[model samples]
Target: MFIDVVPNRGSPPAVLLRESYRDENGRTQKRTLANLSKLPGDVIEMLKALLNGGALIGTAPKDLAIERSLPHGHVAAVLGTIRKISLDRLILSTAKDAASRRFCDLVVAMMVDRLITPRSKLGFVRAVDEETAATSLGNLLRLGKVKDHEPYEALDWLLERQERIENGLARRHLKDGILVLYDVSSSYFEGHCCPLAQFGHSRDHRSDRLQIVYGLLCTRDGLPIAIEVFEGNAADPTTLKSQVDKLKARFGIKRVVLIGDRGMITSARIRDDLKTSSLDWITCLRAPQIQALAQGDGPLQLSLFDERDLAEISSPDFPGERLIMCRNRDLAMERARKREALLKATERELARVQANVRRKGSTLRSAAEIGLAVGEVVNAKKVAKHFALDIRDGHFSWSRKIEQIAAEAKLDGIYVIRTSVPKGELSAQNAVQAYKDLSRVERAFRSLKTVDLEIRPIRHWNANRVRAHVFLCMLAYHVEWHLRQRLAPLLFHDTELDRGRAARISPVASTEPSASARSKKAIKRNANGDPVHSFAGLIDHLGTMTRNIMRMPQAKKHPFTLLSKSTPLQDQAFKLLDLDPMRVQ
Candidate 1:
């Protein structure tokens, strides 16, 4: 006889109990459990994650009590509107694959936290266990749907919301008009068998590894607006045309101009892309072959040119070839300072060597590298020398070093620029300034490298998910970059200082790198011997908004009615997000 299993709309198929089973010919009876029901949420969560794209076999899961490893443990809360909700609940809404979703969430959080952590403290393995990680990440994997690191889901998601985002941008954003810098770069990862991971030229010279294509779009303000994935090993010049064409078709862009490096300015490609839309482009020119007419400043000569000036020159192949030259007093001072520093450095070396020879009681010597004793010791003096270096043969060393320093200082106060811009529209000086803005792209790359994203050693085994991961990073980049621009006025830029330096230096001092510029490394080796700044320190300080967990006091207020104290950053982030901190719901 058969009995009805549980009858419920959402209940899983019931496990069947066989009362008795008899063979047709012989007299035999058997009983067994049949038709097992849906796998438990926790177990299913695991299975789904593995299928989606979590690397569990190679990794060890977190040490969980073997008894109840089902529900994963602990998700750190973020700022603004989404903090109070449990990690699982917040993630529960749309995970198609339970396992992948959990895994994705953890990884995303880890990525963010890493960005805000000091690089010196960064390591490959920060998570406790592989299995535990698998669980948290499963949720993201599930929603992603297409297997480990698929971009299809992300692409579909973006396409679905295209109308809304475009409308919002058209109406409210792009106030400064859209200056789109379109380019393609590739990210490399170790997994070669991955269909997505194909051979490509590595920007970091890691062609030894497999790579995939990535497209980036940025605002003139250095904000990343969108990221797309192309086939691995795609050409940069060709990647340019497609992205430019696609953006025009999909978005409501007003006054869009394409800015690209010299590599992308192909005449044939330009004609093809222009035929598709009426977009303007600005590109750097390789020096054009000079004409005797241009040589003598014949008619049609560039109008705005000076010792420090910008002048536009007309070119048949391109338009808006405005040449500009500009002088920044600060840059000029830096030039002088650097030359003086070099002289001082050479002079110091000469003195040190002279002292060393005297202490050793050795004869006069030549230049350290040149091996030429290019000076004469016309005078001799002995100064008390306690250190390892000695004072001797003063004159012979002095004359040659002085000559060398003078030669070095003589070549100062000069630089130049050339452009194809029309003579009347722009000057050589202004054109040079515009070209200098190309540094913005470098700043953008630094963010992609250290601050908001990590695009190297791609580990995704699947084709689509790799793309999706990159796309999401671009999204985060957009958010954080815009936040930086907004926060700049509030926090001033310190040319030479970072958070650590800020603690020692005045907060308002104009010589340090502040939180806004923390995304990029501002200091290079300068002869001044100033302290180096750290991005890691700035991120740790700024991102760490302090909070105190308190027990509600015994009072008329209900336990559920308790409130927490306000944090300055929390309040600021809340206001920026347009969230109500008091009413979390």
Candidate 2:
């Protein structure tokens, strides 16, 4: 028997219970069992349940309860991807001991939290207990009901296997002859107890606070391979030698080209360390070096830019090395605009000082004080070279050094990259491209510091914990890189093809309606007619696919979990990642 709704014109639909039977001649005949609308609500529901193959003895309305509702969809998706990569297995294989496996799970859990909702290590236990109920991580890793100290202890265990874990990652994602981008960044500390924490150049602009320096090594595409932490006082150039040794000795990478910013590795160090070790490198020149290249009769003079934006030349100062000089018109324009703004600001500040000197009733300041005031104005603008300041008779006057300004302006938007890779092996254009890829390491640092993983405010005082914390954040970044690559169609990723030379592609302007109009009209497609969403929006979309727990009354039956139906877009995302959305089951 089935309950069928009968349509009636200009009236509410009629609900009918219909049953079918075969007559003696094998012809079908139907009869009305009952009118469901006329029956009691409970009776009608029971009949509906029986017809739909539901349990007849379901809990009564008053006895039903919701055990808990969790935000399980996003966590499940991340964990599914994590398992597909066999990250947990790779980590566990380092040590077969039970404690090691548990610690591995703890690390994985921390990484997931880092990606989803970052919090302090002490707060992670509560986050997992509340937010990750649908993931099997707790059961698989045996991290149920974590103690506050377990995460720290697990970090200690994980730190012991850092080399092994890094080796595994290198084997998986790295290969010989790949361009590896490296850079260093410092994270400030909340308290200075760690031996590695000391006063250094704080990249986060927290110079007043102590910091710890860490270097990240990643592929040209920004997939992090290894991370190394050092004392806060370690110099950027000083860290390169150890990393080169690790690449050669530990990872066995023989033919890789290391790309770094000029601040990280000087020309001298490249000559001394990389040349002797037979390792190739690509790095840009400092401003003074670029100026020297622009000196009289040099190959990198300003006249070279008139013919082309890039040129390959050999310099006598750097024998047997190729220098790729590039000048960007847009960069030049930007620099010119910035210098004008700074000059104006400095003029206004100097005018204020000059007014004080000319005022009749002003305090009688000494010549030294007036000189100091003039110095402060020029220094603050950082354009002292372009200005000539005069202090005489407790008065000040200044004028623009037109020749100096013109000379400095001649070098705007110009940069030179020095590389040892032979022209036949790597062309000058590719060398420029490779040196520019140092921005990928910069991107990684941005993600680590401000974006997904906030690897700052180093609360861990112990050296081991600091290292482990950085390692955990890097691991999380590895996962994030894969996700972003798969989700590139929805993100503003660098998708231009390399055609053996550099090509600048302007972003295609969206012709879609304004955001306000789109919101009112419920528009979700981009100008390309593809679905448009920010990374966070996509995550929130997938998060709609949740796990629901339904339970009977207290002291009755145990609760059962059911997954919410996935939308087409959510299913597509899972398919792209090759993940099973229902893997939690």
Candidate 3:
């Protein structure tokens, strides 16, 4: 039986209780059981619900209560993505055994925790504990009563499986005749205990702090494949060999082209590590090498870029290799501006030193003293080569190296791409594009170090622990990269990358957003009139969706979990991910 409302002309609708019955001819007909029109609307709805077989637990509607609510939408999005990608299985192949399965759960939990709210091991455990849970992550993963040391143990187990896991990823993403992008980065350490923590070129600008360097090997489009940690003082070039060997021997990939910056794939490393191996390389020429190419009667003349931003040239020094030269007017102008600014600043500092030397009762009485004062000012700006200094006992003089500065200015905004791939295999234009693709790897590093993952302030005292920590962060970024790709439309990230490239006058031109992206930026709304957000903003917005624990006066002892209603935008995000927030776990 059900309640049916019938419209009446010029009067209130008639609400009637009705039942379905079969007549003698076997046709279905509805019969009015009672007139519910005189009853209140609430009572009528209650009767309808009861007729539909929905149980009413309490005597009154107000008897039901919400006991607890936890942030759940963000958990659902991230954890759902992890499972959707089969990242849990990737970490540990089969969870049939209870103990291995639980360990795998802990590993997966640690990874998602980094994405959701990056916390230390102790803090993560406290955040996911049943009583002190910050979100629905604990309940969703069913990770009950986690101890502080369990996370560290999970890291140890992950480190042991790093090889197998990375090999699996490499096989999935890498192939023969592909461009493999590689780069190295460093993060400062909090203590001096770990062997890998040594003071080297501090990319974090924390020269006072010990650090560890790590290299990331990725596909040309920036999907992380493998990562290797090195001692803090390790040189960038020194880290390339292991990655090369890993691709050739460990990952079992052959005939791949390795792309790196000039500092990484140096001439020496190439001759020693890569040249003998049948591997190809795509790297840029260092400043000195570019300067050498532009010297008197050299092939890399400025006129080559008069009508174009990119051109191919040959060099006798680098035999049997193709060199593609590119110039950007904007980059040239910016470099000139910075150079002049630094020169003026250094001149001001040098003037102070000269005055100190010639001032009455000058303390600089010897050449050593005068040279010491002058030396500090010259190299402070790193444009010391642009200045010529004359220092003697109780005297100091300085002048600009005009010829040197002019020569450098001529090469401003100019760079040369060096590649070993044949012209048939990869054209000059494509090679330049491949080298430019290094920025994608750089973007991954930014997400890992500061932007999203915060893979810094290393506190692990064990070498393997430190390695596992960085590896975990890399895996987290791998997940984030996929998330960003799927969520690009809702984010400030440019969705029409191909369109933007098409709009550019030259491949070397600065990037510009497409028309649609510009509109989104200006109006702060997408085509659907929904607000566009940054990745972080979108995550926070999803966090607003919660899971509530509900109970009633009649069934207070057996509370049920209920998902909060999701907004349209949240629904769209789930749609994009092809996930159901209610059934995430």
Candidate 4:
């Protein structure tokens, strides 16, 4: 017997049960067994299955329950990216021993944890333990019962292989004659035990705390190539030589264009380290140098920017180099506004000091005392050169250095980009753009210090561990950088920035986001009408997908694991990442 459906003209299809047999003459015959049209569709199907000698079983929520569930999708996305980029293999040593494998996993786990939720080593270990299991990262890596000290030990192991790992990254990302961007930033320390931490220009504005300074070298696209740690007391320019040596001696890059800020690629550095070397460089002129260029009879004329925002000029001081001068009205307005504000603030403070000096029986009576008080106020804003002050016993007066301020204002919004690369190899526009790309390094510093990956408040005491800690963070950022590029469609990041650059009138003007980016920002959604997210927010949303352990109470058997069905958004994320959330990376 079999169940079949027959069409009845325009009416609903008729469901029927029938039987077939053969007579003595071998002729075919059939009979209607039942009119199953009145039965529910599922019931009819079940009847057909039973007639075909198939056993039927029932399952209900009460029979099977979810015994355990853990967050898994985010782990899959990030860890999957790590494998996609072969970061694990890049950082791992050549040793194939089981311990080496586990250590590699440990390093990867630490990096994943840092991206997911930055924590202390002990805290990370606790989160990944089988009992706690805050994220599926630990279980996915098969890091069973991670010890508290293992992460530190992994750092030690990683530091030993830092050169090899960096060499691998450089080989992957760097090429001869490419633009290499380098910038330095400092992060404050929590304790005084580490030898690398000391007082320096606190980018974090924590002068009271000891800090460590580090420089990041990146490709023209802003992907990190390598990083080096220095004593917090190290000046920005002082760190350039070691990087030069590393690029030539270690990474074996014969020719490249190094991009640095004016502070890093100073005149002294150029004359000493880079002038005689094969490496070319791109940097901007300092305020003093720009002032000299704009002086009377100099090459950089104010009228040069009247018709256009950028011009290529030359001077005897910078021979055998291309100088690209640029002006932006917006920058000029902002600088004028800030200078006025600082001047007003300084005047107010100085007026208070003058009142104290003139008051009867005032403590600020000596000329030395009055001069000291006046110096503090003028130097507070570093506009002392723009102010004129007079100090005498029991008397004080101040006035704005109008001529000087006017001289400085003439150069506002004006900057000169200097490069050793020739005009044929790199145009004036591209040279200015290369100098502007230094902002990418600045953006990386923002992400490293305060935004996504917090690399500050150093607690490790050993210098090597400190170095390893920083390198690990850089690796984590490396993974994140690639992930962001892949997931940019779903993110608030402007994926059409290159188009914007192409549309820009001049490289000197401020960059504007693409129209699509503007729409995304206004609507909080992408072109597909899905919600857009910051990188962190997207990671958090992906964590909603979980792995569930299912059990049958009556069977008294072992439980089986099943992944929760992904939401549309979660599915879209995995698709963008080209990852399978069900598979462990």
Flag regions of model 1 displaced more than 4 Å. Answer: 1-172, 175-177, 288-308, 316-435, 489-539, 542-585
lDDT of 1 by residue, 83-159 (tens): 32122232233546855454544444433433443121123122223333322223322333223233234334444
CA shift at 493, candidate 4, in angstroms? 0.6
Candidate 3 has what TM-score? 0.91
Worst 10 residues of 1 by lDDT: 378-387
- What lDDT tens digits, residue by residue, belong to model 2 across residues 1-585? 888779978987778999989999999998897777677768877778889887654457766565665555667667777787887777788477877777778888888778777789877877665345444335434467788898999888778888988888889877898888999989999896789999988888888999999999998888898999999999999999988998898999888899999997797788778988888889888999988878788787777777578877888899988888888877888999999999999999999999998888777367888888888888997988888888876677889998878888999888888888888988776787778767688888988888778998889988999999999899888888878878655544433333212334211111233343353235555444457576667766777776666776654667776667777777777777877766652
Instruction: Kindly list the per-residue Cα lDDT of model 4 for residues 157-208, writing each as its tens digit.
Output: 8898889999999999998888999999999998989999999899899989
Candidate 4 off by > 4 Å: 1-61, 554-558
The clash count of every prediction, one per candidate, is 73, 0, 0, 0
Flag clash pairs in model 4.
none
Instruction: State model 4's lDDT.
Output: 0.90
Question: For each candidate, what TM-score against the reference?
Answer: 0.50, 0.85, 0.91, 0.92
Tell me the tens digit of each residue's lDDT in model 3 across 1-585: 889999999999999889999999999999998988999889888888899898876667778888889999888888999898887888887547787777788888878889888888999999888889999989999999998888888898889899999998988899899999999999999987899999999999999999999999999879998999999999999998898889899988779999999999999999999998878999999998998888899999999888999998888999999999999899999999999999999999988888888899988778998887777877788987998888888888889999989989999999999999999999887888788989999999998988888999888999999999999999999888888888877887778877777566677777778878998999988878878998878988899999999988767699898888899989889889889988988
Give the higher-lDDT candidate: 1 or 4.
4
